[model samples]
Target chain A: MERTPVLRSEWLKIRTLRSLPGALLALFAATVAFSALAGVSEASDPGFDPLFASLSGVIPGQIAAVSFGAMAVSSEFHQGALRLSLAAVPRRGRWFAAKAAVIAAPALLVGLGAALAALLAARAGLGRAAGGLSTGEQVRGVVGCGLYLMLMALFAAGIAALLRSGVATLSLLVPFILVVSFVIGDATGTLADFLPDKAGQLVLRETYDGTLGPWSGLAVTALWTAAALLAGAWRLCRRDA
Target chain B: MTSIDVRDLTKEFGGRRAVDRLTFRVHPGRVTGFLGPNGAGKSTTMRLVLGLDRPTAGSATIGGRPYPALREPLRHVGALLDAQAAHGSRTARDHLRVLAASNRIPDRRVDEVLQETGLASVARRRVRTYSLGMRQRLGIAAALLGDPEVVMLDEPSNGLDPEGIVWIRTLLRRLAGEGRTVLVSSHLMNETASFADHLVVLGRGRLLADTPVRDFIHARVRPRVRIRTTDPVALTSVLARHGHDAQEHADGHWTVDGARLDDIGRVACAAGLPLLELAAEEGTLEQAYFDLTGAETEFTAQHQEA
Candidate 1:
């Protein structure tokens, strides 16, 4: 069958889900709120990077992003919905690709809008401290923040598919992004730069002193997302719905 | 028109075969009841036919093509594997809408099915709030959304009221009347007898009987004679001497298998026994089904022990 109708069906599923839109709303609000707070309080720190601080609200907001991805895939596993979906489409690969496309598009759009709002909100508090940021730095931070959030959402979605349980995906990811990346990140030194969350966040930094540059950091995160998605696709195809 | 053809289909889970080289064809313009006991693999066979699970051996096709090979499969074959398969958070209308959109079916067909299934009033309600019978209606609405040539439902009459059951029976007959192939699965023989024209019976992952409903009963059912006499001992002796398989009931009635009512009465008259009552008993579809599946179960048990 042609792919357009299947994609349209998937898009309808996402839009009709009340919790999904709520999660996106939470993503936007959390990102903007936390960035404003970081700008006000963290601006006094001697080592503060203005670009990173302005976009730092994504640190907390990305939780909602992860949830959006995980829930979208997990709902299909609930109540034998996957059986109905596959029966209608019959081609598991095509249905899965359509699902991925719907998830990616919404996450990317909302992530970009949220990042731009966070940067402006935080810059309001940073005042003179944020003045050192050049236009190029600000643009990179905004764009990188959006892409980073979208990647994290996809990363969570892929893991959810692999695990076949949204609760498990959230349980594994929320902790890894919150505790491992934040607490163990410093102790691991350069190794932490390759972790999905840390690597992606590096793109938001104005200047980095690591083996990876900004774009390469996002590329590493993309690699992690790709691996997770591949594993999910394999499991979906191999198992009986 | 699409017809389901399953050839040597086998499915094994963890070394235990669920469907053992089962083969059957469901033709159009009639209701084919997929009959089996629990775990007899009726659902598994349906899943294989729909390409939901890969068969361990052989193939299942619809209209000369595998299920996955069909473009817009919903328009080719519509199936309801589980009544509760839809997401609870979505409204019944949206559930059907999602399925219709997948096959490029017209949006109005969704409303038509809901109306046909008598769920138009509750179409906007979330499925979580629906009763089991209501959920069944929603499932049926989904199956009919594309107006497909082939429709398959598994245990669809479960949790339905008597009226709902009758509704499904009429719906199945109407679909078959339209020259569409319909396959419905259930463990209850009497229920299937009410609506199905042909039956495909399974026992212990194996095919037990495949024939028309009337022929199934005629072939599997054994007619017997129920006799009551004034002198029990003399009549029993006479019946025993005549080589009849007669068993005494708790209510003082004797049922003689493989015996004619007239012959039993004549023999009793010649033996000088006064017959109080003598009548022929006709076997029903329920009894016939029990006889076939019950014997198969015993044979399977002994075969396994061997």
Candidate 2:
């Protein structure tokens, strides 16, 4: 069978699911809300990068994006949904590809909208402090921030497919992003640049002192996402529904 | 119409074989009852046939092609492995719409199936709110959406009300009458026996008997004759003297074992006994099933614990 119908079917699944749409709404609200709050706070340090400060809301906003990706695949495991889905499409690879596409599209779109909104809301509160930022830097930060959020969502989707449970995926990912990354990064500086969350966020910074450049940092995160996706595909094809 | 051919199919899960080297053929124009006790591997065999699980050995094919190899599998064969296989949060219509969309089926087909399965009124409700019977009806609707030539359902009568059961029986008969292949797996032997023309019986993951429903009963279960005569006392004494085991009922009926209708008629005529009623009876499929599975237990020492 042609793949177009399968992709459309997967898109319908995401659209019809309450949690997925709710997650996207939360991603927009949390990112914009937190960034605006940060914009009102005083700049505590001399080395604060205005661009990174304005985009910092993504730290919390990314939780919603990852939740969307994880929930999309995890729902299939519940109540034998995967069996029905596979019965309709049969070929595991085609089904997985269609499912991954649905996750990527929404995550990317919501990520862009949230990233742009966060930048504007923060810039409004920062006043003159944000004025010194170059136009090219702001543009790069917005675009990179959007791509970074999408990558995290895709990464969570991959894990969800492999684990076949939303709770398990969220349990592992949320703690690693919130606690492990900060604790490990604070303990060691150079190694933090290669971590997926830390490396990808480097693009949001106006001035960086990390070993990886903005684009190169995204490359590291992209590689991690690719690895997770490939592993998920392998698991999905090899296992019985 | 299509045919199902399962040859030496086997599957092992955690070192225990769920489906043994089972072989059977289901042809069009009849409802083939796939009957077995609980844990007899009926569902596992169905799963293997649908390509939902990779068999450890051998193969199962529909129309001479593996299920996954078909260009449009649902158009050729529609299967319902589990009734709870749908996402609970979506409306019944949306569930079928998305499934129909995947196979490139039209929206009208979804509405048609809903109407056919008596789910049209509840199509807009979330599956979570639907009863188990409603879920079962939705599953049947999905199976019939493509108007497939081959239909496989694992216990379609489960969770259905008496009316729903009767509806499915009529539907299966209608599909078979159209020269379509229908394989229905159920542990309800008598229920299946009523609608199915053919039977493919399994016991402990092995083929027990494969024959027509009537033939299976007559072949596996011994024939019996019930005789009611004007002089029951005389007939009982005569039968005992003739070395025949006969059980007497208070209503002047004697049940004779291993006696043909012709033999009884011959004896009654020679004895000049007036017969009020003489009828030959066969055991039901339910009894035959127990005999077959009971016999299997004597030969096989191991079976699935699940």
On TM-score, the candidate that comes out on top is 1
The residue-by-residue lDDT of candidate 2 on B43-112, one tens digit each, is 9998888899999999999999999998767788888888898888999999999999899989899999
Score chain B of each candidate by TM-score.
0.94, 0.84
Clashing pairs in 1: none
Model 1 scores what on Cα lDDT? Answer: 0.89
After superposition, candidate 1 runs with Cα above 4 Å error:
B295-306
Query: For residues B13-128, could you state the per-residue lDDT of candidate 1 as single tens digits?
Result: 99989999988899999999999878889999999998889899989999999999998988888888888888888999998888889999988999999999999999999999
As a whole number from 0 to 100, the lDDT of residue B80 in candidate 2 is 88
How would you encode candidate 1's per-residue C-alpha lDDT over A1-241 as one tens digit per residue?
A: 9999999999999988889988999999999999989888856667678888888889899999999999999999887788999999888888888988998888888889988998998888989988888898888888888888888888988899999999999999999989989898876587888999988888898878878889999999999999998899889999998
Looking at model 1, give its docking quality level.
high
TM-scores of the candidates in the order shown: 0.96, 0.91
Q: Is the docking of candidate 2 incorrect, acceptable, medium or high quality?
A: medium
